[model samples]
Each structure stands twice: as C-alpha cells, then as structure tokens.
Target: MENTLQLDLNRSSHSCREDFSEYVAHLQLHMALQARNLVPNLTQAADSREQLLQETQAEFEKLVSRQMR
Candidate 1:
C-alpha cells in the first residue's frame, strides 16, 4: 500500500510537469505576440514584459515545488 501510494505520487508529479510545460509554451507564445505588437516602444515593452515574466516564473517554480512535495 505504501509503495502504491508512492508510485501514484511520482506519476502525479510527472503529469504536473507535463502540464506545466504546456502552460509555459502558451505563455511564451503570448508574450512573443505582445512583444511584436509593442514594436514602437520596444524598450519599455521589453522591460515591462521581462518583469512580468519573472513574476510568472517565480510562481511557476513555487507551484512545481508544491507538486513535487
């Protein structure tokens, strides 16, 4: 029973990682589109976008850590 529970936990972690990867891909594509559209103000756009991205990444890391636990 304990071993089966551990196996389930491992599988759930892998699935979480897979889902997280897909989510990251979608987020990156959206960011790229926003960057493209902000071409006229590329410098400010890039800065703002990078800040947003960092926040998102931090959150994602926390979420992944929780799933691993």
Candidate 2:
C-alpha cells in the first residue's frame, strides 16, 4: 500500500511539472507575439518623427534665406 501511494505521488509531481512547463512555453510565445506587433508601430513612429524633423529644418533654412535677402 505504501509503495502504491509513493508511485501515485511521483506521478502527480511529474504531471504538475509538465503542466508548469507548458504554461511557461505559452507565456513566452504570447510575449514574442506582442513584441512582434510592437516593432512595426515603433518603426512607424520613428519614421514620422524623422520626417517632421526634416520639414522643420527645411522651414528654418527658408526663413534664414528670406531674412538674408
């Protein structure tokens, strides 16, 4: 009887470990997808900022040229 109980406990422990491992794998996948989604949005925002800076610089140069004339 004691040996049977020990076997049951071992099985339960193994099952729990498997469950935890699966949960961790799923969490990692979810995080990777989220990061993937964020990359394009971040890239777009950076592109927009760079475009705005270029426009501002061009306007400044135009203003300086007018003042000199």
Candidate 3:
C-alpha cells in the first residue's frame, strides 16, 4: 500500500509538471502573437513622437529668436 501511494504521487507530480509546461508554452505563444501585432503600432507611435518633438523644438527656437530680437 505504501509503495502504491508513492507511485501515485510520482505519477501525479509528473502529470502536473507536464501540464505546467504546456501552459507556459501556450502563454509564450500568445505573448509572441500579441507582440507581433503591437510592434507596428509602437513604431508608428515612436514616429509620431519624433515628429511632435521636432515641431515643438522648431516652435521653441522661433520663440527664442523673437525674444532675442
């Protein structure tokens, strides 16, 4: 009876490990897909940010020039 219990515990542990590994694999796949979708949007946002910064910098320089004049 004791040996049977030990065998059962080992089997249960192995199954749990397998389930955890599968879950992790699925989670990673989901994250990779999500990241793939997000990359283009992130790139566009970065470009927009750069454009805004350039515009703001140009305006600031104009204001500074006016003040100096």
Model 2 regions more than 4 Å off: 41-69
Q: Compared with the true structure, what per-residue lDDT tens digits does model 2 show for residues 1-63?
A: 999999999999999998997777666656555644543332233577766755665565465
The TM-score between candidate 1 and the true structure equals 0.52
lDDT of 3 by residue, 1-69 (tens): 999999999999999998997777666656555644543332233577766755665565465445433
Candidate 2: 10-residue stretch with minimal lDDT: 36-45
Candidate 1 lDDT, 1-69, residue by residue in tens: 999999999999999999998887677666655654653422333577776766665575565555444
Candidate 2 residue pairs in clash (backbone atoms < 3 Å): none
Of models 1 and 2, which has the larger lDDT? 1
Candidate 2 TM-score, true structure as reference: 0.57
CA lDDT, every model vs. true structure:
0.66, 0.63, 0.63
